[model samples]
Target: LAKTTQPISMDSYEGQEVNITCSHNNIATNDYITWYQQFPSQGPRFIIQGYKTKVTNEVASLFIPADRKSSTLSLPRVSLSDTAVYYCLVGVLSGGAQKLVFGQGTRLTINP
Candidate 1:
């Protein structure tokens, strides 16, 4: 299984864009990479998922390379409300169960 590492924290100003990158050099064949976002007192919400190439939604974009060793999350025009912890996870879904283990995430602080 692949393990991920990211910065412990980051700082950004409101209306600026932010990009958080995670490194996972040993991703497994059955594993699918996913990203999540969590506020102060809330559970992490699914942001995006991708096996390879790019996947984008309203909130973020995920980019994966051919080696699958790393991925990047891009948030455009972030705001103060966007301050939160971002997690990168790798696992497989089985029997309709999504069991994921989250690593120590990147804490993003959006400044005014």
Candidate 2:
């Protein structure tokens, strides 16, 4: 199990790509880093998840270091709607239950 560390706040202009980084120095061997986005008063929405190297999807891309100690979430051409709290977490199975351990989310403010 590992705890993540990320910035508390970030600012970006509309139509610009935004990248947020998370650090997990003591990550386990079989851990997956998952990223989420949550708007105010709304539940978190799954963004992306990865194990090693790079994983890209339609919405975002996840880049992980070889040592699995850190990851970066990249959003291309972000807009105002992308303003939200971004979370980095590690999903693990505990006693037949899946548990998501997350760090303090980073609040991203997208301006026009």
Candidate 3:
């Protein structure tokens, strides 16, 4: 299994673009980077996924460098409601991508 490391916490304000980076130096070539956002007492919601380069969706964008040793999750113009814990997961699609192992995540706090 691949392990990920990210900042313990972050702070932002309304209408701010927040970027969270995660390091996975041991990630395998077949592994993919997945970002999830979880609100209090709720299940994590998938934000985006990427193997290399960039991937964008309605909520966020995932950027993976060519080396694939790290990835950055970009949240564009976030609001106070965007406050939540973000997780960077590394897993292989064939190995059940949805079955991500639990780990410490980055807590994002949005203020007015």
Candidate 4:
């Protein structure tokens, strides 16, 4: 199950909420949905993770449906500094280890 899809880029004004959606139509039952945010020249930072329904963190909120086929990462009141590449990933436990496959990330640009 490697099929994942996301928008290439998005533009938003500061102080607005930003939501990035990812599609994983072939997602497995045991897989978990995770999101990561990366700034220029910096490693990706974990945002949130969820298996179903909704999970909220200080930085973002993750929403996964009961079908588990897709997820959305929502950033509240984003600022210019929040501009970054957001990655959606599916992780599964395999052979006593965690395996994650990532898809093309969405580049979010927060404007003034």
Candidate 5:
């Protein structure tokens, strides 16, 4: 399946909750939704992953509805340091191997 659409850049003040939505209309049943965060001069770091329902981690939470065609990445109480690019990846993992494709991600800028 193709990667989801790239959302527009978002701006938020510190101490706010941010939710970025990703659309994968043709997502396959085997596909899993994964979110990543990237900072300047650094590689993308995994934020959360889910096949359906919801998945939460220390950094972020991923929400996938029953259809699994779209997902949202939720960040709570973001700070200025949270300003970065966020990506939503779709892929199928099998037998310890994964093939994930990414499109242009959303740029989230947290202001003071």
Candidate 6:
């Protein structure tokens, strides 16, 4: 399994952009890195996924280095409501009796 590490917390002001980087020094060949965003009481929503290079969506952008050891999540014009926990995960999706495990994520506080 590929283990990831990220900041425990970050502070950002409203209407500004925020970027959180995660490191996975031992990423495996079968593992694909994915990012998730979670609000107060809701389950995390998928932000982006990339095996290599960059991938962007309407909510955020993900940039992965060539070695696939690290990735970054970028949020544009973040608002107070965007204050939440961001998680970077590296694993393979499984069927049958498999379940996904989450890590201690980066808490982003958007101050107004």
Best by lDDT: 2
Q: Give Cα distance to truth, residue 54, candidate 3, Å.
A: 0.7
Model 2: lDDT equals 0.89
lDDT of 5 by residue, 1-112 (tens): 4557768699999999999999877665687888888999999998888999988988888889998878999999999989999998886444456566675799999999
For model 3, residues 45-69, the per-residue Cα lDDT tens digits are: 9889899999998899889999998
Q: Model 1, 20-52: lDDT tens per residue?
A: 998876566567889999998899999999999
Model 2, 44-108: lDDT tens digits are: 99999899999999999999989988899999999999999999997545555556779799999
What is the number of backbone collisions in each predicted candidate, taken in the order shown?
0, 0, 0, 0, 0, 0
Clashing pairs in 3: none
Off by over 4 Å in 3: 92-103
Model 5's TM-score against the true structure: 0.87
Across 14-55, the per-residue lDDT of candidate 4 in tens digits comes to: 999999999887666687888988998999998898989999
- 2 in model 2: Cα distance from truth in Å? 5.3
RMSD of each: 3.8, 2.8, 3.4, 2.7, 3.6, 3.7
Runs in model 5 deviating more than 4 A are: 1-3, 92-99
Over 4-94, each residue of candidate 6 has an lDDT whose tens digit, in order, gives: 6899999999889898999877666666788888988899998888888888889888888898778888999999888899998875334
Q: What TM-score, computed on C-alpha atoms, does each candidate reach?
A: 0.86, 0.89, 0.87, 0.89, 0.87, 0.84
Q: Where does candidate 6 have its weakest 10-residue lDDT segment?
A: 92-101
Candidate 1 worst ten-residue window by lDDT: 92-101
- CA-lDDT, candidates in order: 0.84, 0.89, 0.84, 0.87, 0.85, 0.81
Candidate 3 residue-wise lDDT at 35: 87
In model 4, where do residues sit more than 4 Å from their true spots? 92-99
When 1 and 2 are scored with TM-score, the better candidate is 2
- Cα TM-score of candidate 4: 0.89
